[model samples]
Target chain A: MEKKKEMVKTKRAQKKDNKWTQNDKVFLYILIPILILFFVFNTLQLLKGFYYGLTNYKGYGDYSFVGLRNFIDLFSDARVGKSYVFTFKYAIVLTIIVNIISLILALGLNKEIKGKSVLRGIYFVPNILGGLVVGYIFSFIFTYILPAIGQMAGITFLQNSILASTKSAWIAIVIVGAWQGIAMNTIIYISGLQTVPEDVYEAGMIDGATGWEKFCKLTFPLILPFITINLVLCMKNALMVFDQIMSLTKGGPSQSTESISYLIYNNGMSGGQFGFQSANAFVFFVVIVIVSFLQMKFLGGKEEQL
Target chain B: MSENMEKVTKEAVEGAVTNENEGEAFAKKRRAKHKKQSGPVQGKTVNRVINILLALGCLTVLFPLYMTTIIAFKQPSEMTNDISGALGFPAEWKFENFTEAMRVTDFWHSLGNSILITGVTVALCILIHSLAGYVIGRKMIKLKAFKMSYYYIVSGMFVPFAVLMMPLVKQTAQIGIANRFGVIVLYTVFFMPMNVMLYTGYLKNIPTQLEEAAHVDGATAWQTFWKIIFFNMKPMHATVAILTAMSTWNDVMTPLVIMAGTDENTLPLAQLNFQSQFGTNYNLAFASYLLALLPILIFYIVCQKQILSGVVNGAVK
Candidate 1:
């Protein structure tokens, strides 16, 4: 009887061990294919960008590498230079204004109020809509309402075509950008505000700190982490501003609003300057990385914190 | 007991030591308590004022939308003129503009194309993202050890659509799916970073033992994941579904680039087509814009909670 029991136990253990090995093999086999595909696709895309950047391949036949000529052309191109400046300015201004407005709005809405959630939802609805839709909607405002307001108020400040003037076009674009973007910033700020312990605020209140003092001392410091994140996102998203610019102005009124992304789109898809466009794209990618990295480093402080 | 008596005696001494200090502390406490009592009442009044102010502010936000919607129904003369009419509720509700807009553009055909493209993209996105997330989440994959692997996939997020447009268009044409399902799949891949982040974040909170128990009960890895893990991801699935659906549904740029060779335009592209076709008819153009926005508006109104919930959940992290 003892010998029979030992045999059965050995058989059961062997079956379980076999299953474990099989499961390991399955995992190994499946993972290999996924990893290969992921690596191959990503590398191909990156390599294609680099390879195309080096060659003057204008969407045609065999091409040879023209070392740094495209970069030279990029520098000399007046539109590219102006666009670089314009995009940078727009991004900086938008990031600052949007972050400030959102932080204020978040604080305002965070107060004790009924239907606050519903109001927040209403505010956020525009964000869910496409950038193009928002742009299209604003186009009507700039073209119609602004002119009407100018007529009613007897001021030619905005005029019929706000985007026609270089000075005002960038401002209009940034305002529209900020308006569309406030929801994301507000949400992030609210999330950050939630992390601040309630006792901290209570302590501040007991200390007889004024609202402004409380904001500058307690709220801003506590929300610095979120501030960094919101700034980074705002910068990146603004730098890549495309659809809104497209529907709103199409980088128009003598190309004052021509963002880098729009310029790339025009050169590559519209102009058929694939190689030059690829180089521009590479430069844009580098700039974005450096700017984002510098911002993160400055704000993140310690490496471990990031 | 001695400690209690000593604390009482200390309080008594404090009360008697400085009448001024006691009076101030007592008065301040009373004031604070009173303020706390009336805080909600005052808060409501302030909120009411704020709400009205915010509503006025929101009118500024909604003015353009209102103008567009109203003028779409109004005559061209009415639209071009500063007529004294409220932005909402035109004096005469005209249904003819809808039909006129439909006729001016190939609205039905374009709508069909948009729906097909969006549907295919969403389906492909859900499939690939879920499959990839499941394997990475549950399986002890070797390359998963290389932490950079996930980053490599996610790094595609920041590669702007413009950068990829030239190469993607060329590749899609070369592969002969530029205007077909290939475009859809590539679109799915283009925006997969957020999905991956969401799923990974979500999966981290789930226990691996559930799948392990299933595997122990004689199920394949895929089966175990499909039955146990994926089923449990209802909220995440709902959020991703709505988000990706909204994204693909409203996308204009991708279809514009890929579908340029053909009249296989989406609703947004169709609106552009309508604008060019009826350049003089601003009313028709605005009507076409309204038509394109109608389905999305309806969807948003119906699924407000889902849409808002998705935004809050995906964004807060």
Candidate 2:
């Protein structure tokens, strides 16, 4: 151990001594090609996406530069507007519900429960299946099983599949999204809970704190960082939610369940309006960046204060 | 007894005589009570209630999966039959539904395409991400440009691929790369940011001694990295590989837009086609879902420990 530390120190010294060397050139040789490939394939394509948003480009053939025309149409496009609203609602609802429920599950598992591991594994099992498959599974449950059970038991609301209605479709999406996405947040919360030292809880107990009180005063504040990470992640996933929505509703009973990603997909790929869809895609990217940034700044600053 | 001894020893060391007698008596009562049952009666009841609730929640989560498996085995006619509730086991299990669905899906060709695409994507993803992560992390070149390039790639993670993909629809058409190999290339470049993040965090922790020792032995930089640094990166690489591989395997939109309506069918696309082909046979549809699910489920069951830890680590970043 001592020798390792000493050797690391000398390496640091060597770095300062030589600054840059002919030997250092080898790393650049490896780095440059990867950088070039990324720039051409991923980053350059993003730049092209931005450029296409300003033009009259279709899927192919001829095009002309129609400055700001696509962006102008974006304002009046009723479907695009509805999708943005739906995406926001889905993101907000799913993030809040999933985090709350996941926190509860994490706290429950942290307690003195018999078969804690078994219960946790079961809760996390859905996460192993893709969002696509889980959506299909629940589609059957909602359409065939739940309604049949409801009809057999004389429950009117349950007898009608939730996906058939707009209001209930929102809830159904949350249910499926929460099922597939909750496990990771729960795991993260468990890890965050474990980080709170035992002595901290002991001190709280010494002052006669109740369970809810300890959670409010100690656990929540300490776990704020984990909460932020999970929140941002859930928000992003909910915003991009495509596979599940496609499998569950196919944006139907009348295009009511179409998310923003689905909107871009249907417009660009199916509708053959490449340039116009690229404009919508550009706005979607900006909205995500802004929302995530604002969330991180607000919550992240609060985290430091705690 | 362990609890009692700990409390007694702590009190003795503190020299705090206040409540010392009460503490000892309480410890004895606790030890005696421990032999009869665990904890207070009220707390036990509360815990039992919580456990039962948790168990119910687990069942609720597993219900859909349970339904899929049960119905997948039932004959097509049994779906509407009234022998029992839909949740009940099939009276007549027609496993032939799976074989029929398999035939319609061109299961062999679709499975081959999925394997080839995912296999090549994961191999290339690991190669580039690790190679880049290593050089940038170790600062072997000691240049500001390399670090800037690192953040440049990391920035791609925030821009939703939904938007990035819009232009590719046209561009790939123009270039005529929207085939099986085309989607493979997209997955390769698309997944780099995440892989790099994981590898960078890992590579930063490694000590410089191994590389320096190799240097002293007259080893070339390639030889040292391939032989020494790569071994230490195995666990992180496995984490990255499993995660990216699963996403690529389950991917639907990519193959749908790029490779669909052609002979180059990925599993999800094939399953989608199967739904249309056997529109009325719910049995066959469920069978296809199961077949589509089986491969990834098996992989996950085998590598779950690595996967769970990978998720936590990747998110905690």
Cα lDDT over the full model 2: 0.79
lDDT of 2 by residue, B253-293 (tens): 88888775367798888877766666567777777788887
lDDT of 2 by residue, A273-295 (tens): 88899999998888888998898
Which pairs clash in model 1? none
lDDT of 1 at B172: 70
Number of the top-ranking candidate, with lDDT as the measure: 2
Error at B154, model 2, angstroms: 0.6
Which one wins on DockQ? 2
User: Considering only chain A, what is the TM-score of each predicted structure?
Assistant: 0.87, 0.92
Q: In model 1, where do residues sit more than 4 Å from their true spots?
A: A1-25, A31-42, A195-197, A302-306, B1-44, B83-89, B139-146
Error of 1 at B73 (Å): 0.8
